[model samples]
Structures are given as structure tokens and as C-alpha cells.
Target: MKKLFSFLLLAFMVVNLAHAQQDPQALKILNQMSQKYKSMNAFKATFTQTLENPSAKVKETMQGDILVSGPKYRLAVSGQEIINDGKLMWTYLKDVNEVTITENDAEAESMSPSKIFDMYKKGYKYALAGTEKQGAETVDVIELAPEDRSNPIFKVRLYISQKDKTLKSWQMFRNNGNRYTYSINNFVANPTLASDTFSFNKAKYKGVSVVDLR
Candidate 1:
């Protein structure tokens, strides 16, 4: 479950990257994000995730909130949660009551960056999908391709609201020949969130076993 959510999160990183200076007007607007995004070190947002399979069913709506600081962060969903402290990746499933801790040194986990700028430099293709005004602010719908996003995971797309350059929605393509959809319902940036909230307590689930994958 988390593995898929992580991928969905990674896809967002790709869309949030700064726009190339193809237009002076857009460049100036993109530059302004520098100041606005500083307070974005932390965000608390409710996510509605839908994972699909070919099992004659539809997507499952898993509600959750994510607290992130790039590689050092955590996401709580349903009754389970996943955490990363820049050193470890912990996944705890409340239903099964199992906790799996692993080293954070994974190719996928390393993609964690404070901003989208990191992803563009890592070889991602980006294009603009015109623009629309959300309320009083405008948004640029940008789409990304890894230039080699054929992993059967799915084709990824992103909506970057021009208002804040923040991602608004995302979708994933699964190899099961199914489509998994995910969206951010609301967001609160750099709110007064607690620090320990991102930590995992092994003792909290004494009945569950700890499986270290690293």
C-alpha cells in the first residue's frame, strides 16, 4: 500500500519542478515561487488515494494525511502509517498490526527532495497544459514523462496551480493494465504540526512483529 503511495508522492515531485524559462512572463512568475515556497518545508494535507487492479473491482479510497520534509517525513493512512527520518523507512500496518523498518537508502526513496527542482535535473520531461484561473489565482497544468516511464507502474500526470506552483492532482498507471487515481483534497503548508507526530513507536504495537527489510 505504502509502496504505491510513495510512487504517487514521487510523481508529484516531478510536477512541482520549476518551469523552464521559455517565456519571460512565465519565468518571472516561476521566480516568485522561490519566496512563496520557503514556508512549504512542511505540509499537512488529506489525500484520497485510489488503487485499481484487474480483479473485477474498482479503486479503493484510502483517506490519509501526509507530513513531509523530503526524505525525512511520514504519512498516515487509514489505520496504518509510514515514516522516514532521513535514516530509516518504517511502514506499520494497523490492521495486521505489523511494522516493517528498513534503511532509507533506496533508489525510490532517494528521489525525495525539498522541491520539484531536484526532479527536473534528474531527467524528467515536462510540458505545459495551458493555464486556468482557480478563483483569483491561475494554475498551469503540467504533465511529466520520465522520458522512459514505461515501468508498467502507469503514466503520470500533474496539475500545477499557477497560484502557488503546487500540485493539485495526480494519476498512476499500473502494470496490471489498470489505472490508479490519487488526489490531494486540501493542503496546509508549514502549519504548526508536531514533530514527534512523524515518529513511529514500536512499543505502540507490541503484538505486531518488526520485519527489517534493509
Candidate 2:
């Protein structure tokens, strides 16, 4: 009985030790990338977003440009534009010539251009998945699983350039087996952006309908 008790205790200790050994390398790289992005005053990027679902046999791709300055951002896609001025958000639908205005809820976890950089800081367990070569650069792939299992998003994969510590791409895996991928084609750091770049000027769009949902 004594020998059996000692073996059980040893096994418990080993299990506890293994559980305590979380990888710090992945967290370090993510922190470095976040710091580099936070240091920049403003930036612009052209990106391609792809949504795919193998089970549903659906795939769609769209190209867009984003201008971000702090919490404010203007995202212009093919048929729509989203402008957030830190307090209010305006989503303009070019097809309908209408704009929906709503309050920008800061408490929500948004995957917008301004919030994407530091998104891994909360509600996630991240680890360095692996490394892969993309074109001429080697990228570090980090995998993040949401702590809340009930969350719609199951996993998020971030690809960071190993050379410049810049984010190359990120992919989101949804609970419904749908995946969304965003890849940056071009990036300009600390660009001379206008002060009103993030705001929606209603006068600019002549004869447009506005729907206020705020």
C-alpha cells in the first residue's frame, strides 16, 4: 500500500509540472508584434479577405484597403465601406446607396483593422504552431484557441513575418466550420493620413439614405 501511494503521488506531481509548462516563445513573439504596431502613429494597408466553407461548398474573396489611426479606422471594400470614428460606426453599402449608422461598441471583441494587432492579448490560449515560407519571407504561425468554448470563433491563426515582425496574415476558424482569411498585400507605416479619414461625411455622398441604428 505504501509503494502504491508513493507512485500515485509521483505521477500527480509529473502531471502538474507538465501543465505548468506553458510556452513563452509564442507569447513573446506576439507581444513584440503588438508593440511594433502600437508604436506606429498611423498606417494603411491593402488586403484580401477570403471566406471559405468546405462543408457548405462556399467560397468568396474580396479586396479592400484600410486606414487606421489608433481606434479610428476606415475600411473600404469592393461594394461597401466601414468608417469608425472611435464613437460611431457608419457602414455604407454602395449597391443600395445607403449607410447604416450605429454606435461603435468598444466593449465588444471586434476583428477590425484597428483592433487586429493586439487581439491576442485577451481570452485566448496561444502557442507557436510552426513556421512556413511565404514567397520570399519566412513566417511564424501562431495558433490561438478561445478560452470560452461557446464563442462562435473556435480558433485564430496569425502569420507573422519573421524578418520584420509584421503581421502577414490571419485566419479565423468558426464553430460552423467556416474559415475567414485576411492577407495583407501592401502596408504603409506612419503614413500622412488626414484627420477626417476615419469619419463618414454624409455630404460627400449625394442623395444617399441614412439609417440610424444607434
Candidate 3:
């Protein structure tokens, strides 16, 4: 479930990298998408994640939601809730009524929700794979491959709406044959957020066990 959260939270947004080798068309679209998110104060969205492993004949789908504001975010999925308020992080398990706390490591932000919008700013090559009809919208398909071959996630594909330049969905291909697809079901740009939205309030979770790993 932690692995799933890593990729699920990354579906939020990404900024562009100035790579000369990147396809011009893809870079243009990426820059536009980045600008769209950079202009927002905060955003909230609901998504559906489908995990599939053909070899194991395993397939599962779940619904999730996320709220992001700068370096803070709150994500809920698969019976778990992860809250990061820039300086710290809390992971709560619903079934066990336990919450683990840890200091937010800045170094890992590139792969975490805080820096998801800049994940593609380095160590990746991207290109526009063309466009296709995704339900009612025509989406531009962009494919990205990590320059470092050893990365667990080998490739990623993003679908952005051609009409509004918003991300519709993304797919992550792992080296271990696990494929995860996240589709944005609903999106709200620049929603007003409460100050405590990103903080973990233990009081709300009655009888929740606290495990401080910081």
C-alpha cells in the first residue's frame, strides 16, 4: 500500500525541464501544463487507481482523493491516509486505528507529494506520443522514460486534455511488471483550504495509536 501511495500521490502535477533532447512538442505541452498548476494556490481532486499484473492475473481498482497546496498535501486511499505539512508526515491506517509520524525529509521530496510538480524537472526524457480520444475529450499522450535505467518505475505515460490542457490520467510501468493507472475523475482548481487541512489531528481519530518514527 505504501508503494501504491508513492505513485498515486505523484499523479498530481509536474514542472518542465529544459532538456535539449526532449521533443519540442512534448516540452511545449508540458510547460503549459506546469504553468496551469503553478498558477493555482491550491487544488483538490478525486482519482481512480487500477493496479494490474498480467502474470499474476491480479487486477484491482480503488478510489482516492488528494488536496495539495504548495509543499503540503493530504492524501487518502486504500484505507490509509497520508498527511504532509512540509515539516512532518503522518501515515494513518484506518483498520488498525494507528498513525505513524515521521519528519519530512527534504531530500526525498522529489519523489514525494511536496515536490511532485517538479519530478520531471530532471533525469528524464519525454516526448509527445500523439493524441487520442479519452471519453469525451481528446487527450495528448506524452511518454516519459527515466534516464537512469535502474529506476523501479521504468516509464510513465500522461494523458492531458487537448481542450483545457489539464491532466486526465497517467500510467506507471514498473520493472517488476506491476502497472498502475490513475485517472482523474474530478478536479477543482484553487479551492479555498483551511489552515489545518494539511496537519494530522489525532484528536479526530478516537483511540488511535500513535507511533512516532521521527
lDDT of each: 0.62, 0.85, 0.83
Sort order, TM-score high to low: 2, 3, 1
Candidates 2 and 3 compared by lDDT, better number: 2
Residue-by-residue lDDT tens digits, candidate 2, 1-214: 9868985885564334334434599889999899888999988999999999976999999999999888989899989999998999999999999999999987662667788888777767777878999899999998777666677876788999999899999999886868999999999999997757888888899999999998
Query: 173, model 1: CA deviation in Å?
Result: 2.9
For lDDT, the strongest prediction is 2
Question: Residue 175: error of model 2 in Å?
Answer: 0.8
Candidate number of the best TM-score: 2
Better of 1 and 3 by lDDT: 3
Query: 1 or 3, which is superior by TM-score?
Result: 3
What 10-residue stretch in candidate 1 is worst by lDDT? 110-119
Clashing residue pairs, backbone N/CA/C < 3 A, model 1 = 139-162, 153-173, 154-173
Candidate 3: lDDT over CA atoms? 0.83
lDDT of 2 at 187: 97
Q: Residue 48 in model 2: shift from native, Å? A: 0.9
List ranges where model 1 is wrong by over 4 Å. Answer: 1-38, 52-57, 110-118, 132-138, 193-195
Pairs with steric clashes in candidate 2: none
Task: Give lDDT: candidate 2, residue 1.
Answer: 90
Write model 1 residue lDDT over 1-214, tens digit each, in one string.
Answer: 9878986895675444323333344344444543455546676678787877646576577887777664466778788888888777788988888899888775675234333423433445555546776465566655445544554443455545665667665565555657656577888887775657666776667888789888
